[model samples]
Target: MMTTIVDLMVFIIGASIGSFLNVLIDRLPKEENINGRSHCDHCGK
Candidate 1:
């Protein structure tokens, strides 16, 4: 039971990190600001 909980936590952390990196990779090339709040490109709200 303890091992399963640890494995789940590790998976969640790894996935979160991967998603953040993916965002950086997609945005950096377009010269977008990563610090600001994210919004839709079509509406520009």
Candidate 2:
């Protein structure tokens, strides 16, 4: 049904956004800028 298709689309979109946010969180603390390798929190390097 159309409603089911819309729900699926919304879910997929939300998942994609969540994935991007996860990447940001994983990287941002390792960096002060937009692009950097994600690293462990315990080490300063």
Candidate 3:
């Protein structure tokens, strides 16, 4: 039980990180400073 819970937490954390990276990748080309704070792909920050 504990191992499964820990594994699930790890998966959740990894998924969250992947999601953030996906947002950055989707936005970096047009509307963001890649080294700076994140914002939507269609808007500048």
lDDT of every predicted structure (CA atoms): 0.89, 0.80, 0.78
Q: Which pairs clash (backbone N, Cα, C closer than 3 Å) in model 2?
A: none
Ranking by TM-score: 1, 2, 3
Where is the poorest 10-residue window by lDDT in model 1? 33-42
Model 3 lDDT, residue 40, Cα: 53
Per-candidate RMSD, Å: 1.2, 3.6, 3.1
How well is each residue in 1-45 modelled by candidate 2, as lDDT tens digits? 999999999999999999889888877785655466555558956
Order of all candidates by lDDT, from best down to worst?
1, 2, 3
Off by over 4 Å in 1: none
lDDT of 3: 0.78
Give candidate 1's error at residue 42 in angstroms.
1.4
**lDDT over C-alpha atoms for residue 13 of model 1:** 100
What's the TM-score of each model vs. the native?
A: 0.77, 0.69, 0.65
lDDT of 1 by residue, 1-45 (tens): 999999999999999999889889978998998777777878978
